[model samples]
Target chain A: MNPLRPIGAAFLRFLEATGRLSEFTAVAVSHCVRPPFYFRLLLRQMIEIGYYSLPVVGLTTLFTGMVLALQSYTGFSRFSAQGALPYVVVLSMTRELAPVLAGLMVAGRIGAAMAAEIGTMRVTEQIDALATLSTNPHKYLIAPRLIAGLTMLPLLVLVGDVIGVFGGYVISIYKLGFNPGIYLKSTWQHLEFMDVFSGVVKAAVFGFIVALMGCYNGYHSRGGAQGVGAATTNAVVSASIMILISNYIITELFFAK
Target chain B: MSAPSNPVPKIRIRNLCKRFGSNVVLDGVDLDIATGESVVVIGGSGSGKSVLLKCILGLLEPDDGIIEVDGLSAIGLGAGEREAVNRKFGMLFQSAALFDSLKVWENVAFGLIQGGRMDRIQAREIAFAKLADVGLKAEVGELWPAELSGGMKKRVGLARAIATTPEIVFFDEPTTGLDPIMSDVINDLIAKCVRELGATALSITHDMASARKISDRIAMLYKGRIVWNGPTAEIDRSGNDYVDQFIHGRAEGPIRMEVRAP
Candidate 1:
């Protein structure tokens, strides 16, 4: 009884936490659709979530694209299939690396930021002050972030797609001795609209998940400074993992055949 | 002075009960405040004074109670109803709780712009006027909350509380982190603000000086109930041992604080 007691309690706690997260997500999303929208707050968050996140997301996907071109050349050279390099770089960048890498990078940046900001507010009782001011915290704090995440990620993914493909072009033409015109031609010829579309869709979903986890962890944070630190770490880690998991699920949905 | 034949009080609580896990915070407490009156609830840390204020503000729900505000039931209100009730209230939290993201004037103007749906230009004008009332200059309103000193933050918080001229105002530890001089300044501001606006005021403080200065009547909360309540002039001679020990700040008394770990 003693040996199993701890495990049973741990499992129960996990279930309870999961239930709370689900309920929190539901309330946050519901508030996002309701009236009394704070458009100024929404615009502020768009600048915070999308524009400010560009440099990090751009750099990550660009480097990943460049590295993919170089590595694919090295591996395919052995099989005498080095002609597939451009196709591989374009397809992978649009379908996988652009959205997933961008998601993870933004999760690391925005997730930690949202958690720290909201967590500090929680500890300082600013959230309670909002309640007293006749404002709903869900509508004021969570909804704008959710809307920004939903609307901005697709744009971010599109920008990532361009930068990533350009990166692959730069490496292939300048470093790999491939002709610039042919490389660009092959990349464009092989790329379909669905490839970019799917990644953008994934970006939107990843954005929602990232912002939701950030807000949820921060809103529920208590204690003080240490609690805010834990919430920040939890926001980044959980958002990154959820991005990976959802990427696979989304990819399977798009191209399971 | 509260007679059975009198009209309804501005605020009333009957048999309020709130428990947190196994630790009971409030237990069957009843109290009343008349219109335009100042009432202060005094208690030490963990005595649930904050919890009582949160319950009244609709930030926390009491397990069971009847809370009447302005002669209307304020318990278990729906979201729209709760917001409606909350329109009449303003709170100054322990740390001032100013929104760090906003400029001082924006923080003060938040209730007017967000809740009242007033135009931003008009709200900013009101916010600056309120800031001036709290002895802050118009330039001070442009700075963010982080730039302000502790005392300045409390003043800004006070300005925000009275920005809309709310009918009811709550001061939660209004002088918690200030020096003696600053604490006295805040108490004076609170008294002046409540009086000038003719607002009903309720405050919770462990600072005896704050209680004595701001409140017309004082109540001491012990073990989640009102142990003593009377006019501020009578606090020193209230004769209740708990009140006696608290007012005098003596370590020995009927209140044996649980100094050890739970």
Candidate 2:
């Protein structure tokens, strides 16, 4: 009946879960680097994670860029600092918004799919079948996903950066009655290479997190239909949370004095 | 009970014990299968039959037991040894557990291409041949698992299991969900497949008809222990109350179903 008992039990459960996840992550990473690589599976995953996600990432970033320009102009006009609008829009899109937004979108899309597919496999004994077939589930199912996610997200974010900046340019020139050439010049002038570089690095880490969480949740799912449903929800939710948390840590590493 | 006298059984289990918390699912179970011999373990739901099979298959580790395949201990085997042991096995799941992402032919050819490192072309040919052995056409192999019917899925599962020509094959409730006729057909296919390959067969099922049809020897598991073991021909006269009750499908017997109010 002790009140402290519940807290101790909860802490123990947390420790147990953390230990399981750490072990799974170690095994997944080891399989990623090992040989007898599945080139065909990796290619398919790259197309799934990267090529198919173009429209979502593109549309999300494009609108985000346009809104940032308008919001910044309104805030800066009172101080007669409206000229800083281009710098603000370009930096925000590259440094934070595009990567984080695109990451959240892809996590909802790819991460949920990975969980549902792998979760179904686990419940149906297909994962155990892989082991019987002399194929490691980590190698056949997870490593390809991790590899594709790590490699493809940066590229998606880079493309997003361009489209997002262009959205801001469109708003500034036509809607806000600013000179197109000057806006572009201003955006380019104040931008540092580190801004884009840090975002790309964050995108890569987010991609890995999304894939890892999806695979981890799905691989461990038990029971049946309900278990898979829970796994899918966990995959998307956990991936999104991890993306936001990691984004800040990477930002601090790059931007903090 | 002691295992039957065999010079070197293909698979041997002694003092096998497994439990989930306070619920003991296997208690000091012992059994043996000789080379090219077919054995079926019969038990009702919750009788630990599947757990016994899984322990032998290395899917679940028994808390205490000795499992030997070809005189090599299967428990606690290193990765290389485990993979080698598993390479000799093919299992037909109760659900036919095909990879929905792959076409039927790819599922059949998976072990050959992935495990044997054979080229796809060669593997596909062998896959088609295995499918033919299970009375399936080449065209059927092109379809995905979801497109197939329940019976077709079982046939494809059998084809996949035998495609690699494994030395040992395990069937986990192979005909559980099929119609009576379909079950007989699957049982026939199983017997034919096992005979053609001269493989050691171990099947677990609640269906007495299936056990009688596919097994040379039958073992009855009750409450996590073997209550009876005898040749298939002698099962009808097993003389044990549990065996008689199960084979007859009687509601009133020594075995009672646990149906407690939630």
Best by lDDT: 2
Q: What is the DockQ of each candidate?
A: 0.81, 0.78
Chain B TM-score, candidates in order: 0.96, 0.96
Error of 2 at A90 (Å): 1.5
**Native RMSD of candidate 1 (Å):** 2.0
Per-model TM against the reference: 0.96, 0.98
Give a tens-digit lDDT track for model 1, residues A72-156.
9999999999889999998998899999988898898898999999999999999988888889999999999999998898899
Docking class of 1: high
Candidate 1 runs further than 4 Å off: B1-6
- Model 2 over residues B62-130: C-alpha lDDT tens digits? 999899998889998765677789999999999999999999999999999988899999999999999
> How many clashes does each candidate structure show, in the order listed?
0, 0
Residue runs of model 2 more than 4 Å from their true location after superposition: B1-6
lDDT by residue for model 1 (B1-262), tens? 1212336888899999999899899998899988888999999998889999999988888999889998898989988899999999988988999999999999999999988999999999999999998889999999999999999999999999999889899999999989999999899899989989888899999999999999989999999999999999999889899999999999999999888876
